[model samples]
Target: MAINTPPIAFGTDAPSSARGKQAGKARRPVPAPRPGLVTAAAAVVGVGLGATLALTITSETSSEFTGPGGVASFAGNLTGMAGSYLALVMVLLVSRIPFVEHVLGLDGLLRWHRRVAPWPISLLVAHAVLITIGYAQTAKTGTWHEVGTLLTRYPDMITAAVGLGLMCLAGVISIRAIRSRLRRETWWTVHLVMYLALAISFAHIIVLGPSFVGHPATQVVWSVAWAASAGLVLCYRVGLPVVRSIRHGLRVVEVRPEGPGVVSIVCSGRNLNRLAVSGGQFFCWRFLTRSHWWQAHPYSLSALPQPPYLRLTVKSVGDHSASLALLRPGTRVAVEGPYGTFTRHAQRHRRALLIAGGIGVTATRALLEDLPRAAQPVVLLRGTRQEDLVLREEVANLVRRRGGKLHELTGTREQQGLDEQSLPALVPDLLDRDIFVCGPEGFVADIVATARALGVPDEVIHYEAFAL
Candidate 1:
């Protein structure tokens, strides 16, 4: 199964302000529990599983090899080892998906993750069922007191119990129907518990399962995986963020009205002077008033990356953004990075296929300008409800100027969502072309799947998103 990259919904906002101002709403991402926990857990699973396997297959029938006690030792070690390997598979798959910036590019990973949730749960249940059965068999065959001692102190038993229990809870709430019923804040709080589950599961692995307590091979794998994951969390979530914020001290240079509730923020910073980030990437900009630190939000750059002046197109989507209309030019703001690996994969191909839905167009809008339209054939397909198309005219002209094909689908979706549609038939021959997509989560998913059905390999697809 792949890593989950579902979109998140923020609390409702007040009316939007014009460009060059703030919005009435606030935005945030789910906080990693501990700075390095995500990676650290991965390391723990890799080494724990890897070393146990080495010991099990090689354990010779020495004087130590004999009874029910031996049987239980090997069984717990086997299951724990298997469980850890599963965790490792998920972590590595997510890290490898190309162009993960601003969004999950391979919607299949997320779709597959959801689809495979049952398998992990089923494995966990089996682990419990098998162990309990083992205990019952032991108690009947030997002294009950002996069985009690093994059960009470067994290393594998505790970890499997905690890890499996947590997985079950996570699987339960992640279901679509239950997810919709829960408040956003409450749901997040519950999901965060997965961190502890991973830890407890790790604890079970390290303390009980045989092998690697001091072995060099186990130690090396553990250290490497741990360091890598820890480093990522620290860099992207913490260190890089702090540095990006301090160095790129943005001051509002201009706020222009784009519409009734949307404002375009033009800003500049010392770091940005040398940063040189291009279009398609986003920055976390903090308005440096009293509420600035607490008010940081990630917004896409309206201008290309690393510009002397950074610009963002912000929609007044919530209550906190209402003050945006009053934002004074030259107001101080702090910016925390240009995170995400997403960019113009279109550069790799002779032609490009770009898809945008509503504001999702912001994800790839910069790529159109970044590339030479005449040199490479480009096709852009944008989907949105007609009433909400914000920059249709600008996009149309850009597509026209670039010599790219443009397809726009406009209309409202029934409450269920947009009618799932595939790409045009010519899409198959559009091979050798790369695809870039952005928009609502569902919209992006539809387009990416369409591209795949049309024979676009994973390497040729890229995506940026406002959510998920």
Candidate 2:
């Protein structure tokens, strides 16, 4: 991912310089899609379906978790699927979003995705266990009846096997250690297999699951449900890509750094016309020329209000991001987004508390700017070493303009931790104020705990998590 500076060219092609053009063309980079997030998305869809089925078939209920018949479980299933699909649809249509594009940014979504994913896997396991029990309970010989029944049924057996196989594959690769072992291209190829698995599982649900398809109206409803869900997906993914590719020539224009390792990319394409982006959202960026647009990356927008110029603040952490330093000021990159629920509307409290750590300052920075220039009472608590903080200038300006207080900390020094509390000292009414915090995982947790201890109402606490 090193930058390739094309040999300088003169106004006109020199008679003897034809060789350089060919060499430059050959060396030009290509963009590839990032699929880690997408794969995670696919797993989400799989789990949602399995969880829905689990709820439908579960015969028991309890305070902790309800069975299928209970309202809460049903709502959870529906909401899980809808949320995943909505975000997925948004990404497929828009192409780039912060976090999804850069592989880091707005982490709350990813965390929920991770949590929801295991439940679906658990449900699939539960489905298998329950089905086996059902067969064994009915059959005289409980042993081997489950396998025998699966083999005997036509679509039932095949569909379930395919579904389970997909779940297993997704589950095994989901481990970060195992997932990192493969090349990005190889990883995406295997992950896309989830789509086929999803298709198969739908058929299984239609044919076999009792709670899913016992009644005639239920069958119609289920068929329409799958069609509607899949249709929406196709509309965004297939229809949008085709239409946009025809109408838009996707390309990047500039890449610049706002602070430290964070770089902002400005993009222009016909698609910008259809994009009604808002402030406080993110996108999955696939520098179309960067060896992988197929491998999309997620990043948060430093720019708000869907400017004709697109911007993203990226950190140089690893393989994908480490190349930020090499990007030319005029480098071209593909852009996607605007995504995320953390926006101006996301602000609801009279007083807002913004917490930022290291590069996690991006969204909070935008929020600080978008806040009305009023005395709503904002306190920005930035946790970092004296060096390596991003967006200090903008944050300082925001604090100055809004008449809000700002607190800076390198880390916990013994004297400071024991006696000097910056944020609390500056604003004693933390409990009445809304708080937003972002940073590395550990930093986010520590500050969140601090906010709780300081009596910041749980409802007033808002933060954008920046991990996947």
Candidate 3:
């Protein structure tokens, strides 16, 4: 785990010039993202949610609310409907739907997911509390007694309680403090419990919910929506990856060191030219090995596909990443995506400013290759020391070939920082360029905030934050 750039070894790959020509011939053009489709999808989702709420409200009667525990019953029903709808929405957000993912990027989708997550869990908890109280009041018994009665007497109540427990566990572990302490694999495995939780909980809603219990139309609509969400998840998150992995048949060819704790894995695959991927997009790579096959980690390509060869650079930040350095050649690899919207396609201005912090240079390097020569890119590579600036020479060469400017900023953050003044000073024409940044979470946040404070429009300032 030394921090100096080492010569890259491609194993049995042909000469660079020959490979480039073949790669160009083999690579199919990836389509640009359509923001309009995303807008339309958002509208559809809003309408569906609204309809669900309306159905719940319309199903209630004035007489029902005037009875014992009526207020609590009504409130509980509303919260339950809203919470279940939002939970479904949460699932759809991370369902890896290609069109939505293309527009929002995985990072964007994840941000929305985290923000939306609390609502459903909180509402569902409230729903359980309020419902139990309502039932207790109606039965003229204590809340704890009603809870026991429901668990023992009501059909599907036990499974619903288990689902709620699983969902709560997922929510608790997702908190930043707790998540940081867990291994990525552990976190991911716990997160999958959410899918099971949602599934197990659905039966209770259909069987016991006031809105759907006696209403065939409402039941049909609700079932359809849930089924569709499940289908999308299966198609994009499960089926597509399986199909692509089989089609590509990618296998490790070499693992070469780039810098301290950094290694680039080259994989040879079939029909790689047919693999449509943008420059800055990442794939959830699953190495089919005894210790690693059960988990997949997202890593951006350090370089674009070179025909039969594709490369991803990873830093040893955790056990999964560290194990990559020891990956034997011929190890099978399964990839889930070429997902993300951080690409040249996102550029609005004719010129671009690409910024990389530490290991984030991996993404910036690949993205730089995709920029047009006229982009006149200004690349700023920031690192604690010169050695920490991985892939420096390659970035410099790419900059030079494109008539772009390359600046390396080395030292501690206190010594070499990109504040409001320093950032604009480094790229004097910052206002005229689309700024693309990739880095650790804090560094990316600082840069984004500085850019915003400098009056950079939100649309023109794009970034990806690398986190576990």
For all predicted structures, in order, the TM-scores are 0.66, 0.67, 0.93
Task: Please provide, for model 3 over 1-468, each residue's C-alpha lDDT reduced to its tens digit, 9 standing for 90 to 100.
Answer: 222232333322223332432444646778889999999999998998888788878888988788887789888989999999999999999998998999989888999999999999999999999999988888899999999999999999999999999999999999999998997778889999999999999999999998898898889989999999999999999999999999999988788887888888888888887889877878999999999998888899887677688889888987888989999888999999989888989999999999999989978988888788899999999999898888888788888888899999999999998999899899899999999999899999999999999999999999988863
Residue pairs with colliding backbones in model 3 are 2-260, 3-260
Report how far off residue 387 is in candidate 1 (Å).
7.0
- Segments of candidate 3 deviating more than 4 angstroms: 1-26
lDDT digits (tens) for residues 1-468 of candidate 1? 111221111111111221122222222222211425435644865676665567754642443335544465456445645655555444433332222322332333445456645655565565555555555554555445544555577766555566668877877898889988986546767865655665566655555445555456765665476557545544655676677667766667666655556666666555343463544666666786664555556677654533335557666766445566567766887665554435553356767776667666554565565555553534444443454555556566667776666666665544323232335443444677777777667777776776777677887777766663
Model 1 bad stretches (over 4 Å): 1-52, 60-66, 69-73, 88-136, 139-168, 213-224, 251-254, 273-278, 283-299, 315-342, 375-387, 392-433, 448-462
Candidate 2 vs candidate 3, TM-score winner: 3
* 1-468 per-residue lDDT for model 2 (tens digits): 232232221112112213322221221111223547767866875785565445554622353233332343344334433433332333233232433533333454445555556555555555555555545544534537656766676466677676667866876787789888987567668866656766666666556544444466766765675576667656654565455544545444555555556665555454343454434556666655555546667677664423233456778887677665455444445443445655555455666767677777777776666565663645454544555566666677667767787776566544233122755776677666667777677767777788777766665666666654
TM-score of 3: 0.93
- What is the alpha-carbon RMSD of candidate 1 to the true structure? 10.0
Question: All models: lDDT?
Answer: 0.56, 0.55, 0.88
| Candidate 2 runs further than 4 Å off | 1-113, 129-142, 145-149, 172-192, 208-216, 236-250, 269-274, 328-334, 375-387, 411-420
Top candidate on TM-score is 3
How far residue 291's Cα lies from its native spot in candidate 2, in Å, is 1.4
Ranking by lDDT: 3, 1, 2
Judged by lDDT against the true structure, how good is candidate 1? Answer: 0.56
Error of 1 at 223 (Å): 5.5
